[model samples]
Target: MYMSTILKIAVRNLTRYTRRTLLTATLISIGVIFVIVFGGLASSFKNSMINVITGSLLADIQIHKKGYVESIDNLPLNIFLSSEETAEATKIISGNPNVVASSPRIKFSAMLSNYAQTSGVRLVAIYPDKEIKTCPDLAQRIKGRKDLSSIVNPGEILVPELLFKGLSLKLGDEIVVVATNRDGAVNGVTLRVAGYSEGVMGPSGKDGYIHIEDATSLLRMEIPEISEIAIKLKEFKYLSSSYKKLADTINGDTFEVHTWEHLTPFSTIVKIVDVLILMVRVILTSIVLVSIMNIMMMSVYERIGEIGMIAALGTLPRQILSIFFLEGILLGLISTVVGAIVAVVILTILTITKLEFKFGSMNIALTPGIPWSEMLITVTIVMVISAIATLQPAIKASKLEPVDALGHV
Candidate 1:
């Protein structure tokens, strides 16, 4: 009994029950398509959200004082990097090949008064040149500001849209900002409104920007100090490796480095998306397992007489088992190929349509696609489950007695 003969018989047996075979194959194919499409959409959405966070505000990586982030909610001003520490961190960051730009910021909470109304706002004081380079999309988030060269200047402030609308502030309006310094002393400075900034997360965000010089003046600092350093990479794909290298080089008890995922609360949403994907995969596996096993069991029962004839005609038990096993493999292989082709076509259509949806205040377009490795893994799992599903039926057919099988009605 040659392997070719067994395969030919397997094909013949499948065609003999064309309707059943097609139904089983269709079920498995549907499972594959569902998993591929769902996984692709989920991945695209996750990546888009990440890009929004990283590009607009939180750059790919951030370096902060050891305790700065833990108490970030309060915008603590006392725990800051001194001028010497900032200089050292900047030097190390500049030397890293993966870092495209880094901006040192002084963040604090301040009360903004437009003379008629007052609001509490979180202010991030940045050097315009360095900040623009580190967060390229930061300028885009500012309403009516296209020129990145002058995002914010000395004695100027970029206020959040919520604050701008709430306080009825106009460009060039003089606003007084009162803040407490690290020395527990309070000071106030008047600054001109340079522009209105769009919130990164939603409309409720109260983050604003100002010039480092003005921040120092308002805080009454004798020397410049930094709260954090935001770093950008040449590409998002370099995130993991760049983070590892930077952490290895600069992280210590005094300073800590973190990726954008670690710095934002949106990371919890990303994790939930991942768990959903895994659940989809598990459902797909169950579909394949049950469908293949049911088909194989029915196939074995229907061909008992045929099995007895083959066994009595001197066919080897191993050969009979091989035929059933090959049928399962062929069914899995054909269905997987069809499902992959159809999935790719559907994904291509989605990409061409440029499906758009809203996330917060931003309109996001989905670019759904599956990696080759993921597709390969999917195919492998289906085929392996197919073989396992066919095993009991194949073994049972091989062990059937010629007398008992032939006597079946």
Candidate 2:
């Protein structure tokens, strides 16, 4: 039989049971809509949170001395990058075309005193110009700072909001920061509070920023030392390629390079979100399998007499099988197309609504969309599953004996 003839027969048979076909297609369509919409929303949320993290502070990647991360909680000064190592890293970073900007930091734990009150704080000392370039949104997180061109200057500090509130410190107020050097020598420096920095993780964060010059003065170091380097990329999509290149060139026994995901606890939540999306796909697959198989089986059972008559009239078994298989394929194709259109419309509406929500101290807006690749994959899954689900029933219909099927009521 010609393919066209088989398709026409399939269409006629489906129309013969219009209600059943519509119900099955509706179920499959609902499943497709759910998967696409949920996947879009989840992906949008993940991307938004990542932007908040990388833009506000983490940057796209970070470089540090080996074993520094293991003892990061202590902010050990002994493991800082040596002058030579810092120079080499700087040279490599400057030569990389993918690196948009990089900032060297001197991180340490210190006691902050507002004359009457004292608190332990973790401080990151950086060059104002480089830090602003590396972390574009860093300036926005600082309060009452209109001259963002200079985020923090020499003899000045950006205190965490929690610290500022707890110590009753105001901008431009003098504060004393005391710390112990690598050789166990105690030192202190007086700095003016430049601004209050909002915490990325709500009120629990105690991180503050100061100029590198002040850090050198407080640590009493003869030469400038760097604890780590935060780097931004030209584009986030090139992160893997850039990381591999940097790792091959700079990562060694004394130094290490890591992406933002490796440095934060938020990576775990990203993984969990991915797993949940996979689970939703699995559920959609189950729905398609059960709905298509059940409908095809019922169709075969109801049309046994018609199948036997066709066989008696010299219709080949292969032709009979093709007819039933085509019906399943057509059902899947139509339902998937309908579902995709509906999903696109619904997602567009959501984007237009400009839904907003907060994660920690960051506000995020949802812009949900389904990429073409995702839509193609979803359609392929449905079509393939539809064909598989109809196989057993198609075979049963093709193997029926004419005399036995004719004897049935």
Candidate 3:
């Protein structure tokens, strides 16, 4: 039989049972919509997280002592660079044109106390001037103060809003911060509460800031010795080149370079997203398989007489098979196209309204638009499943003896 003849019979047979065909097609469409909508949402969330984390805490790249990261939880000051080593590392890093700004930090954990309450806090000592240029948003999030430009006093600190609210803290409150120094000696500082700022999203792990000078004095840090360097690039496009370039130029086994993704633990959420997508694919594919296969099997039973007549009239068994296969493929194409359009329209509306929600401590804005690649892959899965589901019935119909099918009621 001609290809056109098989298609005509397939479409005609579909229209003969209009309601059933529509129902099956609708189920497939729903599955497609589920995959596309959920996939788009996962992508949007990851993008929002990346923007927030990379913009502040993670920056673009980081430099740290080789063994320091492996035992980062201890705040191991012993693994840190010496004053002369830090200066040399700074010189090599600053030589790169890709570097826009770099800031040195000393990160430590301390117990902060006001007379009435005490809370354990992570403290990041920053060079206020350099950090301001590096993270401009930090300047904007300053609550009580207009900006972070001035060093009002030596022991002033900026607390996160969450911690501030929990501790019932007020500006100009004198607080005591206690910690163990690198030499395993007890150290403490009485610092004035400066102001509050929005918390950073990534792993700088600093809920509060004091001047680098203040930290050095309090912790007895050597001159020019610091914990790590946070680096920003002129453009994000420079990330790959700069990471390799800086590593080669620094040329030291004592230090390791890392990107923001490696620095922030939250980045592991990307793997979680992948697992979710895979589960979704399995669910939607199951829907297509069961729904299409069930409908096609019913179609075979109802059309047995017609199938017999066509075969008896000298139409080949392969031709009979082609007719059913074409019907399933056409149904898949129609449903997938409709479902994709619906998904795009809905996603667009949500994006335009700028729908947002908070998950845990992070705020996420639902970004608009789907990646065409994701949609294409999902539709392809539906089509492949449709082919497989229809194949079993198609094969059964092809093998049916004309005399036996004609004898059916």
Candidate 4:
């Protein structure tokens, strides 16, 4: 009976001060909205960023020869290992279950020229089958639509559409590729342009691709000491574990096995930003709790005389506390529900619009959109703050002596 009476009193007081109650709730709602919007967008962006780098560009892991980085761009032509060692490494990588596929790559700076035009390009020599498995996007492009995917023979090359435009070259146009051979000889190979494309390296380059046989012939070497080895994993979540295992298995004192994160330093930086975002949410929630505490304190002051009357009529001090405490909890619960509804409606509209952004000179990855986990976390924080904020006022109201409270009136 006492509990019922306390709850009724809480409801009556909340109804009577609707304006003040609503104003406090509005502040909490704003904080909740911030969490939902940022959290969802952040998750989306992270996923896109990972896909671009690992899926098309870097692969999950890369193995490199010692001292290769120092002179990779302007390589002094020389073979580093026998074909046997290269074969051994490939076999080891293929046998690992964690490794989806591995590809051998040789990258060199070269000048590709037709009789009338010339352009600089990064010549990458890769096996057709392995390359396709490593970069499915490249295979999809070559298989149809563009007519560039029809070639199965060596000596055929693919040039990005950008390169084609800049060089004024067309399909089947013969071009000369000049680079240093493994024996320090300046070797040149004239080959037919097998295809034209635009995926060589983002926006502005005369970048082109070639088959492994062509690369071997042009460089005058069986294997031109791989500057990079690309590895795909079974899944992204196991990347760290995979990285450690690869390092242990392929433990060469002269080389380093690097995860995509090592190849692209910005991934670590983005994770740091994620941590900072969570901290900011924590600080904002603290501010909301302070506001709630102030509002509850004011409610207690206004009801002091009424509380004293109830106590004099044999109402326990604990019952007086329960009324104020229940009111705070109700306020929190309602605000959380309303905030969630607003967040969902707003997020749904924004997602349907498919918002996009293009940064200066670069195509920014599209935002990933909102997530439900973010909304739940935000609502949870708000409700917890509400409960915590009421504790002080509830205790004070419960401990006040009936005589002292009545004497003030």
Candidate 5:
């Protein structure tokens, strides 16, 4: 028989059992939907976390003195760049045409007391004018006091509501902070709760913010110094090249460059999301493979006498095998196309609806963003697995003897 005749026969055979063919295709398409939806949600979540972290305080890039990152938990002010070194580093960073802004931070660990109760807290003393520009989310969320720009009043401090509730401290309340200075001398400072600020980080709820000058007084150094400098670029895509230019311009021995991901522990969450995506695809593919194989096997079994008759009439066994293979491929193509379209429609609706939730301290919106590459990969996996799954059943039909197959009840 001609190849055209064999293809026509395959189509006719598939059309004879419309429900079974539709059911098999639906199963394959469902797998595509799962992969696409999960891929989109994971990507959206990672992007949200990045925005929250960077918006809170971490700019596109950070410059730290050598050994600061390793000993950061200890509040290692000893490893910081002194006033003179900070000036030189600032000049190098600000020289890059891509650089947009920069701010210096002195982070330290200190104990706070309401005079009635006491708790340990992570304190950051930052320049208000510079911090407000890139972290506007925080600027908009400030409550309790009219102004947060001036921390010059030694006794004023900013605390977030998360900690505000825990401390049982109210606005206009006073808190005392005590800490060991860089020289190992214990020093104390009194601060009045001046305003409330918010942060996306889980720890930010209990963290305290004060003026850089006050931090200088608390951490006590003869010379002014900062733990790190945060730099914002015109576009984050230029981070690598911009970092290289700044690094080469500065003394490498004294300064090290880091992106936001390297500076924060949040990268671990991004990794876990990625792993879940991979595992999900693996599991979904197995389900698809089994469904397609079972459907094809039933197709071959129900038509044993038909296969025998076709073979007896001189239709090649290879042709019989081809028929089953073509049926599986056709089902895969139909389902993949339909599934992709359905997934896209649903994702579009989700984006418009703006489904949002807060995970930990970060507010994340399920922004509908499906990668075209991921969609293509999903279709390819379904088609390939569908073809592979039909092999055993196709081979069984091909190997059948005409006499026995003809006798099949």
Candidate 6:
């Protein structure tokens, strides 16, 4: 028999029991939908978390003074670049096409004390104009403050809302900040709380910000003694390339470069969640594979007499095997198409309706949406698994004795 005749016969045989075929295909479709929807939602969640963290402060890459990351606890007061190095770095970064913008920042741990309350906070002295350009939230949240038009403005600062709440501070309240200078000398300065900003990070929400010059003068550090260089990029995929280029151009002993992934440990935890979600999707796919295997096996068994008759009537054993394999392939293709369409429709409806997610202890109001790329991948994986699952059954059917198979059926 010709290959086309065998395929036609196999397809017709599949259609003969429409209900069973439909059931098997439906199960495969369910698995595919699960994988696609979950993969998409997980991706979205990770992206959202990244936006939240980056929006609050840290940019895509943070270039810190050498040894600052490793020994943040015992920060070396004088471990920073000179004026020339700072100018050089600024020039290179500003010139790089991949670099969107860069801001120089001075970091220190300090205690903010009021009449009735005292809370420890990390103090960041940032270039206001550059910070506003990259982080508009900083600009938007400024309240009870004067105009901020320069990097070396006299007395501008941003404090987090939590700090304000903890100290019962209203706008314009004078807060005393005690910080250690570059020479390990403790110095205190009084700065009016310029504004209170909200943050996604706990520490950031608890900390305070001061003007570049005011913070430098208070900390008694030279204007060139910036501790970190925060940079935003045109694209995140360019992060590694930009970082490598910057590192190569600068002396490694003088500065260390880090991406947002390294700067914020929270992103790492989110990545771990992504891995777990993928593993769950694989497990679901395996379940579908097992179901497909069982469907193919049963299909082969039920058609033993037909297969034997075809083989005995001058059809080659290999051709008989090919027929069974073709049946599986066709079933998989049909399932994939149907599953993709059904999943898309379902997801669209759910998205339109704004499906509410209510897990055991979490209630999140978000769309359960899947992207087209994820849908395509899910369909492809399901089809491949289905084809692989049918291989053993195809081989068994091909090796069967014609007489015995015909007699049993």
Pick the TM-score winner.
2
**Tens digit per residue, CA lDDT, model 6, 1-409:** 4877878987997898899888987877777767776766676566655655554478777777787787665555676656677777788788779987788887778878876788887777887777765554455344445554542245645676778776788767777888888677888888877676655544245556787787778887665478777888887778789988988877787778887888767877787977877786688678667877888899888888887888788778889889888888888888778777777787778678875553321233456575888877777777688779888999999999989888964
Error of 5 at 322 (Å): 4.6
| Candidate with more favorable, higher TM-score: 2 or 3 | 2
In terms of TM-score, how similar is model 5 to the real structure? 0.81
Instruction: Tell me the spans in candidate 6 whose CA falls farther than 4 Å from its real position.
Output: 1-3, 73-76, 137-153, 202-204, 349-370
Query: What lDDT score goes with residue 16 in model 5?
Result: 88
RMSD of each: 1.9, 1.7, 4.0, 4.2, 3.9, 3.6
Global fold similarity of model 4 (TM-score) = 0.79
Of candidates 5 and 1, the better by TM-score: 1
lDDT of 2 at 372: 57
Candidate 3 matches the true fold with a TM-score of 0.82
Estimate, for each residue in 1-409, the C-alpha lDDT of model 2 and write its tens digit: 3898899988898888899889988988988888888888888888888888898889998899998888888999999998889999999998899999999999999999998999999999999899988988888788867788899999999998899999999888999999999999999999999998887767778889999999999998778889999999999998999999998999589799999998899989889988998898888788888888898899888888889898889988988898888988888888899999998898889988977987888878988865556678788889899889889888888888887777664
lDDT of 4 by residue, 208-320 (tens): 67877888788777555665778888887878888887678774765667887766655885687588669757965886688778988999887777777888898777777
Candidate 6, poorest ten consecutive residues by summed lDDT? 357-366
Q: Enumerate clash totals for all models, in the order shown.
A: 0, 0, 0, 6, 1, 0
Stretches > 4 Å off in candidate 3: 83-102, 111-119, 129-141, 148-155, 162-168, 174-180, 185-191, 200-206, 231-253, 257-265
lDDT of 3 by residue, 1-409 (tens): 3998889988888888899889988988888988888898887887777666666566788888887778878777787777777787789888999998988888888888887888888878888777766665566556787545663246798876777777898998888888888787878889888887666542223478888888888787668477888888898779999999998888568788888878767778877897898899899999999988898898888888878999999989999999998987788888899999898887887778887887544567888576687799999999999999999988889888998889864
lDDT of 5 by residue, 1-409 (tens): 4777767877787788999888877877787888888888787888777777776668878888988888877877688888888998889987899988888888888888888778887787878767665454555456677765643245678876666767888888878889888678999988888876666665456566888878888888666688888888887678889977887777889988888878878888888988998887897689778887988899899999998998899878888899888877777778889989988887888888888998766678888665677788888888898889888898899989999999954
> In candidate 4, which residue ranges exceed 4 Å CA deviation?
1-13, 66-92, 95-98, 139-145, 148-153, 160-162, 196-202, 205-207, 252-254, 265-269, 272-287, 306-329, 349-370, 392-409
Report every candidate's CA lDDT: 0.88, 0.88, 0.81, 0.71, 0.80, 0.74
Give candidate 5's total backbone clashes.
1
Sort the candidates on lDDT, descending order: 2, 1, 3, 5, 6, 4
Better of 5 and 6 by lDDT: 5
* Best model number under lDDT: 2
